[model samples]
Target chain A: MSEQIVSDSVSAIKCTNCAAPLNILGGGRVSTVTCEYCHSVLDLNDNYAVLSKFEKVKRPLGPFKIGMRGNIKGVEWTIIGWVTYKTIEFSDEEWNEFFLYSPTHGYAWLVYEDGKISLSMKVRDFDLFSWKVKKPKTLFYKKGHYILDDESYMFYIDYVEGELNWVAKFGDKFTCWDYNGVGYRSLSIEKNINELEVFHTTKLNKKDIYSAFNLEYSSKSKTRKDETFSDDDESPSVFNINKIFFIMPLLLLILAFSSLFYSKTVYDTSYRTNQKENFSIDSSAFLTSIKISVSGVGTANNKLSLYKGDEKIFYIDKQKVFFIKKDIGKSWVSNAIAVTIYLKLDKGRYHFIGEKNPNQSITTVKIEQQVIRTNYLIYALILFVFLLSIPYFKERE
Target chain B: MTDGFTVEKSINCPQCGDTLPLYFKHVKLVQCLSCKSTIFLENEATRLAGDSSVLAPEISLIHLNVPFGYEHKSYLPLGKIRYSYGRGFWEEWWLKDSEGNEYWLSIDEGDFVLEQKVDSRYSRELFNTLNVGQVTFDNLIVTETGMATCEGFEGALPKTVTKGDTYLYTHLSGKDASLTTLELGKDGVETYLGKWISPFDIKKVG
Candidate 1:
């Protein structure tokens, strides 16, 4: 196969995530290239995936002061405080640094001290009228946010004069340095949003356009797209913490009320056992089937007669053991009588009247506590139905 | 140790002394490993007694005891059984060799067949009191040929009768005899009565 001829030096990079090769901003000799897929930064290197280096500027420079007031894309924003950031050293012994600011991203003022235009600010935040940069059509700038065609970056700007000339944009990898620790970048405008895509330019339908930026989608659609990446940048912003504090109390109140309405208590007879005693129960409480048991040698062949007041409801001739099992509401009456043989039980009672021996020693009249009362489960189920119906009712109205 | 069946051992080939396993289902042939020779596996009988005594013991044959008698005379005709078509009007014979002096004969109709055998004294007492057959209350009717009726009676000795002996066959003298009731009297001496009577009497005259 004949080798296809392509340019040896073009500022083109492939998305590290999607591997879609994108022509860089200048497409010329530039120190940096931005990926179209993830809008990640790519440095010029043999590894086509050089964008991995830009993630090195995570922690900002410790403490510095910055003050600037400007109109970014017609939105007025105040830039205050400086953030010096450390970058992964490509070849030098010293770490690379970039300046950071509040509003207006991507276009940071390069801190240059010696040259005639000592403080050179590369403000790619606004839509530039010139076609000087390859693949550049438009660049938009708002408060701490910039959009170049589609790629959006939010970072701080730290511009200095003379010997140093450096700039960095730091939301998701737009960091660069050309000075001696004179400029840095910091986080800005991290929103507590349902959906926000930083960049999505996996496929280039057109050559001039490189990337796209998404600020926020609805709460539902945000989770649909790569559920892992959503809600990632929840920095200490004014909007996000206020939202958490607002919803936290309402959730706690609902949980507390649900616990109160669902309280359950069980009542059991202490004196009643398979020994010589009678057990009485109220029929309505149980939700599932109930079983009455008599075991042990003491009550072996003991006559079990259930009475509804004076009428004999059920009788066992020589019941060594007895079990009156029925669904909770199906029993004749829970108020019926249950008799046992002894307090001091014997193992021999189960053998009376040709009955199988009891597996347990206690000659107990087991008035088994059935499952939770049906009324309670029903009420809970109704409340649940009502609770679930609220959203539908609101939607319908 | 007491003698019983034992697992047999195989003899090694004479040429190579390799052990040969026993073969039973297929043709028995032994193959030698070293010289590649084949031989048949066999067993010889051993004698533990004299020639006359060892000449195979007489093979005893067991015969099933099939009793030949009027087994179901009360229930079916011998040749008529095949025509029954298994419609459940059926009876089967059972020959029982009981202890001496007891006999209980039963014939079934429909789903019920019964036969009772007891000790001799009880059998004698039953037979004496049941000389005449007991008539069931079921399916009794009056027939044309004989006034047939099911009248339960104690078994007794046969009464001697000459030419002029009168006996009523049915208790119903007001209705005609049914065919089944007449068929019952066909097996014995009987006289059909034409009218319902309060008392059925028998008179014998020489």
Candidate 2:
């Protein structure tokens, strides 16, 4: 990766304690300079006065050196400084913060905690103070809703090595609230003594980190060190399923309405007969089948049959009866019953014949023939609804 | 030493005149416990008063004791430095072999990176015009995370450095577990190419 510093030229400065040739890589923003040779912490603003002497903390050296440069997000960043911060309550719980610098973008932070690396940038436009004051459970920004994941206090600054942009002291306390979104995006609200700053962080994969820094990539060392605080209920697949689920019902309505255009009346006829009546009608060659329906108010047995000459093609029987019944606590009651029958016939010329009993009179009889139409859209809609529900239930599962 | 290596010599601190031990010829900085003064080893005969920064010992589960064997070789921890930028910090430990060769072991969170310095140089204009995402450097494609400002420092370093320094950091990866970090500092650009080593690679010596 191309290594580039913000300044066009280099400014060499001697370490106050060691007098070693020390170059200010950060340009004007660097306030303290730790001597590379003697480990003397010098204040850049005050003639390189020794701020604090750094004792050698015997730990494993990281792969990156202070002057090592890598390209991250297409921006060439130099690893200038690093600090180790620990949880106040749990002294053993510590995380490393690497300060990355570029000429175009001033500063970014790569936080490593429990094997998980996250890149965070200061959110300048966010008004964290206003939201922190309100203490809302959820925060809305840009178009995403973020829920408060956790709130804690930073109690300890375990170690500080490289030059830091901020004046951070050991044992400084601040309230930090983390807000988590659906994916790897997160927002951190840190409320200091009198100020609140928001930072936007994105979880990074170790492979990507290696790629970003151009480090030697190793899958074995890329194990997840910490369990991320993720919203389990928010799965991308489930969200997509829900979005598709909503559109299915609308498609079903469209299918139902389309079936209306397919309906065509092939035959329409109504007839009344008190006695046995015989008639014949030729079926249309364009129609596949015919539907016949008969209804009457009568107390007689009636039989309707269609025959091609002597061969019976289709038949329907309508029987009605009158009866009287005696109840224990009621008077004798009489009731008359009516019946209706429907028949589907094939496309052919047929003789229509009706048989009735003379003992009981038939009040009225109506018979109608219409084309047998199938609304495939309604059937398709039923099948579509069934198919769409599969994802809905699977998502719930 | 785990790999049949031995310490060459021990010298006195140049500033405080205290006993300063040497494990490798390339050990740049040493801190004296007697007078709390740092000494910079300029050469075999020249020693200068070295300025230093101190950080509270990090509380960690992993302890350093013996030489770590990696890729059929052994490396002993020589020095460590803590750095801060903005509101964050990280640690880099310097390691050396019996052959006077130097390497850096960077530990942040649980991520471990083993890197060796490169002699290649790159232009500042190349980085200035580079866009975010992926870029090709030294025939390797790397992703740019972001730039950072130099904040503070502690412990010893491999190269000459001041307190407030900034750089453009980029990373490259091969098909394997090897990675390369390019540090674009004010003086020039340097490449440190290495791979992520497992925790088991660091072995305790008898």
Candidate 3:
């Protein structure tokens, strides 16, 4: 194959270890270039000298690759370098740093670990010098207070590939400290001797990363169902449920009040009798049915009858209570009785007759045409209390 | 000066007798490729020997002969300084445009910050009073990132900067990823105005 031209004086240079042709795309800015074929670290400053070599570590293929170009947040970035770093003390934990480069945005890092990805960038305008002197245990940024989450020795570089703007070699180590706040925001402090560098990172969703790169994403590659830092099993927001408890009762109360507008008193009257007396009324003028209530209290045997012009519709007999006492002990004996009745009558005249016993005690009879209405407010209040208790029980669990 | 164009001037290395190319006219110091000797440029060119205070070229990944564009203007790297504070180290590269305008490019890890020195009169007072966290400077609230003690020096520089020097740096963020830095060094205080630029935004020119 023909050689690929990188510049006027430089074409793709062959790797010293594997003789594989490698291109230094960062031009003069890149001092270190890694050969993909043999995993050899090549020194661009010294005519691509073999600075270091490492045995290739096998792993699953990630979605990103060196030299792949994609747009992130409207800026075009190219994956110029990648490094696999593992903790010195914790060998089981490891992460990959994909060095992204954009001429306008400079450099950014995409960190992938445990099937999760986060984008980290150097924060500018931070007052690190004063913060170091204060020796603050926490860092405040973007309305969040970040506390120290983890502190570990610098990660050892296990593998390196592609062109790097900075000089990086295998086995490079430094001390690192991490701070985490609410959600995905994190602050990482890397200390190399007396120098300290701080980086801010935010977790990115897989779908957003896929969309940004315009790549086809499938669930087959997703190994974990939960996020590294997210609390997926936590209860949902309780604000909506609390608000429902307040608004529902008010609505029920309004419905109960509105029912009052449709109710009317069709008839209201009462009758009282001392002796055998009968009363009658003509056919009703109203179209709807009429309702009547009868209440009476007496000391004699009373018989009350309701009829439509002598045709008895209903009748009730009340027996008088006898006040008889045997002198077994000094005690007073008496009995009191009262009765009430309700009836729904059609549009017709009605008669009420009251008969009293032949004694000095008189029987009194009372009747009414008013219908008994149901108290809906009482029913609504009971239902409202039940609905309000539901959330209280849910919160307890 | 045309955008993305670099004008080169050739001169003999005063220390080594080897011919060297000066990429920018305003560059005060140049390092010899053959002998790695630093040469100072002025009315009478003089060689700065035993100037171990110069930053290492590999530390900053800076190449003097290469031209890079920033903010639609092309600049050439001249020299760099290595600084350390606490347990980290960073490098600042001195750059000059074709028109002799000077700027500073700070590189820490993969981050690049481009800045221009401003009046240091007010910055001295800010350095004396300002603490960590957030403070308002020039009507903008900026956070104090850290302070560092200059660990050592390597390459040629524009001004007299010594190793072991300490300075306080603060940053103010702006809309659309713009940033400003306030540097309080041994030589009073200096305010730098610039934004973070991506490596892709900088194009190499021959």
Q: Output the number of the lDDT-best candidate.
A: 3
Clashes of each: 52, 98, 41
Q: Where does the lowest 10-residue lDDT sum fall in candidate 3 chain A? A: A323-332
> What are the fnat scores of the candidates, in the order listed?
0.00, 0.00, 0.13
For DockQ, the strongest prediction is 3
TM-score chain B for all models. 0.17, 0.79, 0.74
- TM-scores, all models, native as reference: 0.15, 0.38, 0.42
Provide the TM-score, chain A, model 2: 0.54
Docking class of 2: incorrect
Candidate 3 per-residue lDDT over residues B1-206, each given as its tens digit? 23443545667877678877555655566667677775777764655645534443442334554677656677877766777743235678888777778889987654678889876546467666665445464545454467877755434456655456677887765533456787777667677888665553566665
Local error of candidate 1 at residue A117 (angstroms): 38
Off by over 4 Å in 1: A1-291, A294-364, A367-397, B1-206
Q: State in Å the error of residue A225, model 1.
A: 31
Question: In DockQ, how does model 3 score against the reference complex?
Answer: 0.08
Residue A125 displacement in candidate 3 (angstroms) = 3.3
Instruction: Please name the candidate that would achieve the greatest TM-score relative to the true structure.
Output: 3
Kindly state the fnat score of candidate 3: 0.13
Tell me the tens digit of each residue's lDDT in model 3 across A1-397.
Answer: 1112223222477998889987655534567888888888888777778887767645334667766666675666667788888888888677888887655456788887766777888765455555656657777764455677644466777778887766666777867877765445678878664346778886777667766666666665554533433422211123334455677777767756654564344334443443333443332322222232233534435555566676767655543211122112321122434454434555556655655544434444554332333355567677777866753554343
> Where does model 2 exceed 4 Å of error?
A1-10, A36-39, A59-63, A220-397, B1-206
Ranking by lDDT: 3, 2, 1
